[model samples]
Target: MALTIAGCTAPPVVAPPEPPSAPNTSADLSGIKSYLLEKTGQLKQATRALKETSDRYYALAKEANFDYTALFATQKDEVIGLIQTAREQWMVASPLYEQMEGIVAGTPSLAEFDMIMDAGASKEEDPQDPAPIDVTLPDGRVLERPGNLFGVTESTLWGTFEAFRVPGQFDFNGDGQIAFGESLPDANVLKGGVDALDEQAGELAEAARAWTPTESDAFTALVVMVPTMSEYFDSWKNSRFVSGEASTQRDFVAISRLADIQDILSSLLVVHDNISPMIRGVDTAQDDAIRRGLRDLKAFVAGVHKQESGGKRFKPEEADVLGKEAQDRADAITGQIAQMAARLGVKIEQ
Candidate 1:
């Protein structure tokens, strides 16, 4: 509407105000913290199981005077049981960790444990994120940041590391033939690594208890952790699950990298879901796009996992192609998210 003022002036038109995008008061991240703590609690249980099994293996070795040949000859059944139990515990604990990685790895205050637990590479590999501790073996050999606790324990249990192997083949599954990673491991190495991992799991849970989750932490997790496709795909390409016998990798063999990637993305999806109301205020269209994008990314990996489960081994080159496609998708989605964060005046940690 226009109005005349003082018999000659006309009032100008006014545009509608832009909608506010204040942080949603309901965007409480205490749920995420609760989920993290719950998972860590379960992880503690699983690692304790590993610790107990490793202790048994250690005690058995000690009983036989640390002689691998004598231990295996007399206590074959016991050794087999301990190895199987340890493997089962690993399967449980690793996924529990993965279920909470979005929170743990995204928060700067707690990212180091991710390296110590799963993501770090070996001393020889000199991984970009190396496990930050040097492990001193019982025999006086120091493993200088020899990798993640999961990897060290897995390699030892599965006989993947030459230094940790028992130097004799045994059909652990009673299949009457030797399979890959079917032999015994060094007792001291297994016990030491598992014990360290168990302790760290407790420490992580303690830190989580002391820490609080903020909108900043949630957003930072999404922005920082969600676009890591190429690195994950490279690992999948080199793993035994994707490369079969040609794979020279060790740790990820116990569980397929594809499975791990899917689990990780699943957790990230939960993180995004929690802050979705805040994102919607900033831009409804973008909020929906990010949501759909996350589902699509997980589905893409799920397709590959289905094929792998059906016994289709992907060549290394093929994995690179798939990885690039996923990377491009992730880049686009995160780009939209980064823009939204800036517009909302939210600070995202790089």
Candidate 2:
């Protein structure tokens, strides 16, 4: 019996099973994290490139010393280029972004919320030119300056660029009524792009909460600053305008109407900071509400039918003084914003 059992056991000796393989962390996240990190780098590079191009354009524009509206055609081309470049880059980057989302979706790195708000791809520049400026003194000394317009006009053209013009795309068709194109939302769609960047920054911020500072911190700061810049530029462009009538006609109103305009511009400068901070971080339901409130305030100030405040008419003499004061305030505001932007690595003309 012992001899039979020994022979049977010798016939079926099996090797111990091999130990299970360890999971490969690097192999599991092969393309996605890499894609996200790469795309993020592209965005950073594009931002810097766009800023440089914009600065160059602005320098050339300032040297021209032309009216605000005069360079509309040139600016249109410049802005269009900017948009095209950005679009191409984004097109390439979107997939990477999607990949990032996929990798982060079921993982520990998942964001509370993430979205990418794309602006209309077909952005174009508006044909905003300078209108004539003519003012007459009480003694009838005419001061006539051609193409001295504000906002999207020639005089403010450079300043507008300094404030809002990006390096490439310029199609302003988003303001459906302002430019030629198919139907769209309000002319304020440009603001949405700015808002989108801010939103991305917040997501990046959340990512940073669990990640390290050296990598995510700079990117988030860059993202947040983009909207801040766009807001400044958009406000500047929308606030000023040039004359439609001849100097002879404009002068009569200058004695009567210029003061009101000065007040409007000054008011814009005052509220700039208030509106900017709200949009500087992220776009949310709350931010939208704030935006609506700000818009209401703007409309209220802009829609004042009467020149009188506190039951007193702004007499021509008093209006002139007020105009001067407003101008001084505007200068101060512009100077301060310029300094702050520079400190933040934004390039604005002196």
Candidate 3:
């Protein structure tokens, strides 16, 4: 009887088969092109706005007899507002410029646009009264211009040029130190910096309008850009925003750096979203991983803020941690994107 019962034991109920995964779809190339065009248009507009604001600042400076104290006393609000506006525009353009680097690299015409617009330091043997570089135009004409635009403007605004040991030059005040909250550089000096920025902005806009990106170039952009971003964050963390001689005294420029990071991530997200369909079509698992990684990186970047004590500044230790985390995340994203590029049979150059 026991044997009969054992043999009669009912077969285990079979579970229903799992559902098949959805088919992946490739992204429309037209959509990506449209996004690029739209972003470039925005960048052009922002740069133009920045130029106009700078022009207004220059005009005000001219009227104020180039005296920092008199300028602040008479048109403090207007001057400060213009500077803030120009800074905001720059914050918007910086990331767009980075995003466009790969495309620019692919286009010979845009080769020197970045250096012209945002050279970090003047390429002169002497910081004061530095000679202008000669840039050959498309028509084979030479245009002489200062190497530093944004950098010079920033230095003037923060009164940090004295750190360069160029005494009595950018030192608007008689004090030995060019500390934060000190008097700004003379109106003429700031006006010249603003003029350079204005000219370069115009050139950038013209270049952006003429440039176009191929599919291969777009893929290369994704591959190259992420790693470049990691490098930028690493530099910022290690030196640009840190304490000691590397930084702008104790000013840190934390807000500016954070804003730039935010803009950069936003631009990268546009590229990611546009290319996501292609990634999904090639490999759904990889696509998911890339999206997740970018999302995490964005959240981490957004969370970063200046920790001020007495005033706005960054502690070296704290900046180092933040910078390391940002760099690591950027590197991870770059690797993940490169995987997608590989799957798509795109060759990314070193």
Winner by TM-score between candidate 3 and candidate 2:
3
Task: Indicate which candidate wins on lDDT.
Answer: 1
In candidate 1, the residue pairs with backbone N, CA or C atoms under 3 Å apart (3 or more residues apart, or in different chains) clash, namely none
What is the TM-score of each predicted model, taking all chains together?
0.90, 0.27, 0.67
Query: For candidate 2, lDDT tens digit of each residue in 1-350?
Result: 99888777655668999997632211122223334455445544543443344344444445546232444455656544544443344334333333233223222333322212211111122123223223232223442322211112111122123222323323355453533111111112222232234345345534634443221222222223222222222222223222222121211121113223333233232233233442343323433443344344334334432433334333334434444543443344344444444434443321
The lDDT values for all models are: 0.85, 0.33, 0.58
Weakest ten-residue segment in model 2 by summed lDDT: 180-189
Kindly list the per-residue Cα lDDT of model 3 for residues 1-350, writing each as its tens digit.
99998899888999999998755544555654565566566666766776677667767766765565666766767766766666667666556655554444333455465555543335443465333444332224443443445555556555566532123332224466755434444445555555555666666666565655455655666666555545555555554545546664322242445655555566556667777777887687887887787777767766664333234456766666777887787788788888777767766654
In terms of lDDT, the poorest run of 10 residues in model 1 is 1-10
* Candidate scoring better on lDDT of 1 and 3: 1
lDDT of 3 at 129: 37
Candidate 2 yields a Cα-based lDDT of 0.33
lDDT of 3 at 208: 62
On TM-score, the candidate that comes out on top is 1
Candidate 1 segments exceeding 4 Å error = 1-26, 127-129, 138-141, 173-177
Give candidate 3's error at residue 218 in angstroms. Answer: 2.1
Clashing pairs in 3: none
